[model samples]
Target: MARRSTPAKKKKTAPRGKTKTGKKPPKKPGGFKRLMLGAAMVAGAVSAIIAAASMLELDRAAHKAVNDLAKSSPAPDTSDRTDQPKQSDMDFSKGYDAPNRPGYMVERVPEGENPQNDTETIPEPRVNPAPKVAPLPSPEKGFGAGTELAWQKFATHVPDTGNAPVIAIIIDDAGIDKPRTERAAELPAPITLSFLPYATHLPEQVATARKRGHEIMLHMPMEPTSRVVDPGPHALLTSYDKVAILNEMSWMLDRFTGYVGVNNHMGSKFTADPERMAVVMQVMKARGLMFLDSRTSAKSVGYQEAQKFDVPAIERDVFLDDADDAAKISQMLDRVESVASKRGYAVAIGHPRDLTLEALNKWIPKMQAAGFVFVPATDIIRRNGVKVTG
Candidate 1:
């Protein structure tokens, strides 16, 4: 066993240097120390970067919060107040007051501040105040007095002719203006002018018509189904009580004088209401006036109501001048003539238009030549044996 043991291999060694033979070579640092130093340096750099990022984020968040608050809040009042700064006066170059400017109150960034994360709010401009208005004057009393006097003068001029089959031409809605009434007076035959009370030119129109020897009547306004209709300023309605009707009637009668009868101007609704019509008839009867129904509504109870009140009444048979055209008017004239020939007499209503007047001028002479007599409305009523209530 001793002979079989093998000799161990000897280890190799390097020779020493001659210049710095006594100095030994520097030993390398341990791997753990180098790794720890490298880690410390990296951590320091990372901390600096994180701090800078955090500061930037904080500033961005502050700016955003300020913009949001401004937008959510109510706008400041700038009208009439000089104490506050105007939108034009705001300095937006610094970005802080940019949000206060007319266009930048929502997201304006301050100068030197990054706009990528900045925000601001803007407000609307104030409007001017409205101007004050003045109040209107009160209406004057007895405004239609002159109109009544003109009518009275007309009534005094009624001729005392014997009763015959009179053909009355009651021209309604007169007294609108002096020129119109004066023109109406030029008719060859006498007419009954139903003048509207309290018209713009009531006094002069009625007086002029009366001076021309025309009979007069009151063209009283009454309510209709349409709310858009203007029944003049003083309209009679079903809603009015007896006192109101009487007062209105009296005022109307006092406004115009020579009216021998009363007629509806636009009494579609009033004529349909029996109770209201009764009141109107009763007032007419008391005033010793006759009643003429314009027949604005087919369902009108005007005739029945007048009879109930013992007032002389008649309804419009034909509106002679309904058509505005000359050809249509001529056709209507022929129809009127046919009716007159057959019935012996007929009551026709026409306006004061130039067309109507021209037609009348031509047709009247023809009728006279044909032996057709022209009579007043009263004469027609009396000749027909229609008893006068008054």
Candidate 2:
């Protein structure tokens, strides 16, 4: 027993973390696990950044597409004038032969200011128009009543002709075609030029025409007999109420200054309505504006209605360029001469067509040499002894 108990063996302790049984204890998580967790966090951050960049690229693509589309097309016109003078207020007056044609714009000038330097572009009536304004607050006020009638105040001065038959060469539908209108204004002095309200550069056009010794009148649009023909923007229609009619009139009258009166433009249907005509005459009388009955319809009550309301009135004796044929226009001029010879005066309406202008250029000087007097439209009204009454 003493020998067996002789050298007691010391327990072998495992290196560092091992058990006495000589098996190593399981390794706790350390640097390798920490490195893996950090790698996972970095990968997540990269994925989020990639997603954000992709979204931004998509947004930029959308914006570029929109900008490209915008660059491809021109903005369409919201309001008035292009040529063709049928029921559509056909801009037959514009001269297509010229370059640098002015775009349609309603340019207005303030009272007592020269329009020669004005560059502001005002808004015009729309193609498919609704009233852009409310009825005038006081339609009757500032319309030139009593002795300060518009017709008398604005009448172009003309030298009296002793015992000569007068002829009024009224150029209708002016100002739409700038080149043609400018050419028309260069014609003989005291020639009456009736302009459409929808034309652009109205103040400048009117001012120039006046300076050249031309009498100005408003070529007011009215309903035509044909439903297919459009009477143009802000035209006076039979369907309009009194307020609507007056509102349209106000818009047109406010376009430019230095005008004697108004005459109908293609108003075959509107001039035929007695009620509508009566409404027109009332405004004329109230405003002291004379009425030139275009006599568009055989059944038109324009003159009679004017008489009833005591509006200084006259009817067209002839139309010089209805057919646009040179021969026809020339023949019509002869007829105008005959009519003037018989009635002591004649009112002939024409346009600024190539043929018409050519015919007029030759005829005017010839007629003047033959003792025929060229006078303003207002002079013809006066020759008939029709005075504006209060």
Candidate 3:
């Protein structure tokens, strides 16, 4: 028993595919090869991400290029649009060239932008605006020396009393204030009414004035000494060229008819310029129109130029409403009587203000009773020893 030894334990052995306990042995872990496979998958994913990012950058660049190109492109051509202005509409550089069309003196501006249908806003001319065109032909060239013109054809009739101190009371600035103008027209007969060409409904207004037995004249606007005082639309500025001057004159003259002559509206500065006055006198001669120099300026050469061109002209001797007061107007009327008494005739200018009209209403009768005759302005021109020729 002492030497009893257990049989030697033999190592247990399974078949080739079995474990010692009759099961297969566990598989060994794959090391480097598996790691390599995992690494490859990760690299493929990273490449896909980078490719997507590059595609996004390219798309952004393309979009930016397209936007820039669109920005650089020009606007679409609208030349075919009917609302656009034409190239030959006007020569805005020289001045506002009135449309060759006959109507009110409308300024030619771009369509739909504050169209000046009534009047033009003229700037203060600082220099001679006359273009270097040939001078107008001599007065004897166009209408022969003896053609009967408007001044004679349309002259108001007045009995020729030899040196009887005739008084011509001219109402300037007529047709603007319709009520006052109508009242003035009703005051007396043969009150020489100088109407502004820009007045509305000129034909009708003038017809009414003429029906009331008032003589008519065109109150041609000219440049004044003060820039603040506007001379209205299409004024005859000293800066206007001969062509422009003629065009403006044409527009004014064509407004209405049956006017005996024209007188300066507010020609303080224009009447003083001899050259401009000469040009105007030539027009007067051509139109067979008389010139009544308002004589707003002391140095006016309008009378002299009229004589040079053989235009029948007269000057204003007294202003009836210079002060706009009834007493002052009465005094001025007295002065007119004095002047008429001394010089055998006088031309007094007044406006259509109520005070002037009222004063005239009372004074005309007084003067009529005092043996002073009231005549049209043209009669006074004839009284000045200048023969009225057609």
Candidate 4:
């Protein structure tokens, strides 16, 4: 005890500052409270720091996602754009131009071009057609070489033997003016076209006559009864020797290619002379040609000489177109028809006059319709079976 007295009563620590009512001040915070306060403060500060860090992380992540998306997406391309043609603005001539050129008009369409719309429908061009050609005429029976034997046998069997009446149409004086001869060629029946030896159209007339299916004959001019007659260049006469006659006949034959026989033109004196006729028949027999006596003279020995030479021979039976009148020619045709009907056939010679042609055009058809078989003169002769003389 001693001095411990009143260590100053510990001075009560001035009663640790009192409340206003003098209640002892509450004890200062304990260590645990201090610790809890400190912990709460630290937690609040940490929460604030964590919230700021999270907000910063969210912003950075959003920015990075936006950058990645921008890198992955594709960019738009605008390279080959062009304006299209409207239907009205389309030009058909863009690729092709010349239609008249050879290959341009024949070009094929391009690949992938729309056939219904892009292709054009062009009208076809017009072209002229070719003209028609006339056909050739046909031959009659008993005319050609093949029918010779048959014609001979048939001729012998004909019932009417007396005079052997037959009709022969002769187209005389025809070897000039080719077109005129061609016009005569239109005659339907087998008419004998008498060709002048030296005429300009002799060959053409002969050819056309054959083409027209007519018979051909040399129109030999001989010495006539009257002084007015001038025999043509190759006329046969009694004054000429056998050699001269042969030469003249040869010269005349050379001018034309096809001739079935010969007929006298103004040969009244020459045809009447028997020796001269015999010389002519000998030449004809050697050349395989026939003879026709025009009968200008009643004393003609032409047929008699032909018989002596054993050549195919014939005589003129009628004269057609002696008058230029159509009515008169029609009368002549009617006479021909009557004669042909009475005696199997008859012969009629005519000129190439327009009147004769007109009359023939009218009457030939009528005759044909009336059962008249108009045949070649050679056919008539062969079928008649009269042995041809010179």
Candidate 5:
């Protein structure tokens, strides 16, 4: 039993076409072959390093080219460059003299993203004190001189709104509050904005206003009634002789462009004087301008002088915000509406006050509902209180 041996077990064989699993052991190369392989690897590494260095050099050259180009070339001419890319400034496709304002543009941007429409935002107005271009030509009488050219340049394009009562709103003391002034210009309704000649950036501000479908006018500061009230520096005074008054007005008139006429700012004493107003109207007639009597005084002879000169003329029916307070301003706004309703057309003068602006923001649109169409000062000049009055 002890000697009895079991049959020897035989190893099983793999099938004919089957292969083993897992990784196979690496095969060794011969000496010369290995040397060749090593040399190939080394060459590949060297080539890669050279390619990387070349790419880096190319990047540097590209950057240097851009820098050189920037240094040698002048900066982009943003002087005429608008906020957006488009065709002409005055071309409008839609309703009632659509805005042609500086920041309002339809540009070809990238394939995506909204085009820059700065008309809805506050425009950062600027005026080049000494522009590189040559100055405008000297003033001549009656033709290319003052408001005649301005009528072409500054007057808002009006639609044929037949038989509609017009409301002309003039905002005075502009160019100070860039935001409110711009907001006033942004109104969809056509209105008028009068700028103070003393403001620093007259050209840019006035240009923006004119582009925004608003008529432009110069707010001519003059002597106020009260002795304590300071109209401003170089104010036209009743005491000034005709020559002095004309000179002062000329200085103010030459300050900017695109204004159809002048409106009194605080000229209580000066406007009341018939002689002073006659002097003012003489200059206005020579310049081909209309006059807007702010009517700071019932004694003002401005409208009378304008009539005498055959100059287009109108007077403010209501001062929108004599009081800066909102409630009072709202009442004044009611008065503006009442006056417009009663007279069929009205000219309302206001300052760039917060309360006034707030009131206007809400009330201006009411003109449409109130059965009055918004118009520029030029429109009122075209139609004195006679034709438009109910």
Candidate 6:
């Protein structure tokens, strides 16, 4: 009891991890410190947003600068012939239809016959009746050796350009837009124009395009990978037997005159089927028409089949305006340049969009300056894997 009196009341100590109130201690800053941390976090978020907005504004400014530069650049258009009549003159000229031909000849009903009495008076077939047999042009003996069985009549005229890179730009999906298609035809000599057989005014439009120094190719509709991708009404399908596929192809091939070849509109599925494609290439060769493997699908065997069948064939190198941005289209043309540089020639396909047209308008001059020659699609084809020449 005498020693316990000296051992005074023990000094109380706080728990290691708890407050005096028996709760968890504040492990991190709190109160004024916590408020300061929250403020710092909010300020950082705002700074990040401002930086993003600034970056976006810089990108927009860069695009604007590019657009302005393109506009300011002078385009030397040698494509437009000095002798050619003005657009105003052409518009008022007597021949609105340049190569005026009886498009889809039809049997006229007797004028006096009553509609009820007469057989179902059919509206004229959209296309002219296809020729049952149009003999393929046999190769002339002049070119010798590898050139046998090749047809030059269908080939577009190419100047003796030596060994310069040749570029073929084919505008597909023509005939739907009369004005734009016609305008494209007038772009430059040797720009290939591929017309859709099902379009209503194909014959007239094709004639005009051909008259304007553009080479022609039939844009044949074919089955794609997905059922949702409707190529068109009479598209060639993998489901079709040889006879049916050939029949539909014949109709498309015979749609118009003066085409160098046929190219698929959307044949991702049909082109891969060797059986169907073999029939198509055989028919193509037999008809004196070359074939362009649109290369819509990576699995397509069209080029190989054409090689095996000795059918003149080439594959599309670039597709312009897959996105309708003018700058992007110009970039695709740059791809065309790379292809042409590598392979001695290249083939690019584009639609009649404003961007495509604009890009071409700017690019044609630049390409010419670069010493690349623009040729037709047929010029680059090969027979038996041998480059064909007339």
Q: Which candidate is the best by lDDT?
A: 2
Candidate 5 whole-model C-alpha lDDT, 0 to 1: 0.64
Q: When superposed on Cα atoms, how far off is each prediction in RMSD?
A: 37.7, 21.7, 27.9, 48.1, 20.9, 25.3
Error of 2 at 287 (Å): 1.6
Query: What 10-residue stretch in candidate 3 is worst by lDDT?
Result: 126-135
lDDT of 6 by residue, 225-276 (tens): 6543456656777766555565677677667777778888877777887877
Better of 2 and 6 by lDDT: 2
TM-score of candidate 2 to 2 decimals? 0.63
Of candidate 2, the 10-residue stretch with the lowest lDDT total is: 128-137
* Cα shift from native, residue 50, model 3 (Å): 76
lDDT of 1 by residue, 31-93 (tens): 998999999999999999999999999978856744443343233332433432111222323
Q: All models: lDDT?
A: 0.58, 0.69, 0.69, 0.58, 0.64, 0.65
Off by over 4 Å in 2: 1-146, 386-390
lDDT of 3 by residue, 1-390 (tens): 478778998996656765567766667658987899899999999999999999999979856744443343233233443432211223222221223311112112223432112112222331212111122223464567556667776777767665455788889888766777788888755789998887767799888888777789999888766554556777787775455566678789999998988898876777887866776776787677888887776667888888777777777777777566888888888888876665566678898887888888888888888878888877765554445553
Better of 3 and 6 by lDDT: 3
Q: How many Å off is the CA of 251 in candidate 4? A: 1.0
**Against the hidden reference, what TM-scores do the models get?**
0.56, 0.63, 0.63, 0.56, 0.60, 0.60
Of the two candidates 1 and 6, the one with more favorable lDDT, higher being better, is 6
Which numbered prediction scores highest in TM-score against the true structure?
2
Minimum summed lDDT over a 10-residue window in model 6 is located at 100-109
**Model 3 Cα shift for residue 180 (angstroms):** 1.0
